[model samples]
Target: MSIVFEPVRGRPNSGGRLTVGTLYYGDARYPIRIEDRALAHLKIVILTKLRRNESFALSWEKKPADGSGRGTVWIHPALSFHFEFSGSKEPEINMAWLEKMSESANRTLGLRIDDEPREGEADPAAARAGV
Candidate 1:
């Protein structure tokens, strides 16, 4: 499946709906409009953390555009289980593409993909087996 990237900005009027700009991927540069409420799963993840009163980091690397540095973002979307980025140090992941990748990862792996690992945890399977 094709991925999409969009620039996100915080809006004052809306409570948590971030504005997006310039969706790019696979010959498509259309506009993207996503509200915080629309990404329900992400919201669930974020709220869970917020309820626990924890802080974390989120990151993604985007494919290079215009031959410059790639897309990436490291932010704390405290209200959701995932995050979005528009810039990256690694060219393979993009902020705009993070949601979809997380969705797919969650679907295939049957687990949550957050920005950081739990304390003392290095692998997903390790937690599953109670290691």
Candidate 2:
């Protein structure tokens, strides 16, 4: 399976921009159904790292709890990256989450997804052990 995510602006707006972009992996493409807030946070982290020519790992939980574990990808500036936005207005920004994710990316472990950044810890080993 391939990993994909949609980039969207943050909430609290009247615009109905459903999807910002289709993140493609290999030959497969999947819609990024994550909430707008989380997606916005992710986009900021990704762009900041890539803009500096830094490569890091991005990990996220997989749906359906199929026992396969979480998904991770190494993001680099050289990759064929693209983000399509449906609206001209920028979404609301979550600075705290972006800072946290940025700090994680700068670490050796890279960035791990916390759908709700304040809700739980991001431990891949713990997640795998649970399954």
Candidate 3:
């Protein structure tokens, strides 16, 4: 199975920016709110999980404190997937994977494999030299 992210609405606000999105798993739809903190945490978790090749389930309920709506997301850790963040608006958060997600949710969520860094890229000395 795969997951898809589609941005329905995006706007900046006083407290913070809000990303109103839709997550798709088959016929089911899950509304997603990507707060700045939540997005940061999500990126870390995704990258770490990909690095270790460890699979785990991610289940969360979407119950807004403001009472817009409620939904749920069931993510199969082992499944090949990608998360695409797509919309006309720019977000305060910027990350490589997040950028790809915006373009095409399916492409981001279906990532079963990720390439390891090049020989020099992983080396601290080389990285320091800007190689």
Candidate 4:
């Protein structure tokens, strides 16, 4: 007989807690660590535009470890997307921040990830988009 064991997962961090989540891009296996709150906002903006057949660029500043430059991608409706969240509870969506992002998505530069705006309330777009 042989005995095997798997490593434990979902261990909490030391000291200060993290509101962090990882976003894995495609089957290529790129992992992007993002704050849970911001990812929640981004999920809305990214999918909403795709639903309307609007294509745009999505950019995020790479961390120092990732070479400290900005990375971007052309986001089109044809591309496949799946958002996986770690927490069982969904992070609250901030409307003001979403509006800021949506407006930027409509611009020529596409959707550049910016620092979050002041937190606010509900998304009127969700109702209109029939989600």
Q: Name the best candidate (by TM-score).
A: 4
Order of the predicted models by TM-score, top scorer first: 4, 2, 3, 1
Candidate 1 vs candidate 4: which has greater TM-score? 4
Per-residue C-alpha lDDT of model 1 across residues 61-131, encoded as one tens digit per residue = 33255233423222233322224333222122223234443443334232233332223434444445787
What tens-digit string does per-residue lDDT give for candidate 3 at 30-131?
344343333443555555665676544344333344443333343455544443343444344434334333222234333221222232334444456887
What's model 2's TM-score?
Answer: 0.61
Provide the clash count, candidate 3: 14
| Decoy 1 TM-score against native | 0.28
Off by over 4 Å in 1: 1-38, 65-131
Better of 2 and 3 by lDDT: 2
Clashing pairs in 4: none
TM-score of each: 0.28, 0.61, 0.35, 0.70
- For candidate 2, write residues 47-73 as lDDT tens digits: 888788889987776555333457767
Tens digit of lDDT per residue, candidate 4, span 1-131? 11111112212234334356655545424656666566677789988998999999877766655466666677887767766655556756557567878988999988865665443334547556875
Q: Which pairs of residues clash in candidate 2, taking residues 3 or more apart in a chain or in different chains? A: 6-32, 20-84
User: Which runs of model 3 end up more than 4 angstroms from their true locations?
Assistant: 1-16, 22-37, 64-77, 86-131
lDDT of each: 0.33, 0.59, 0.39, 0.62
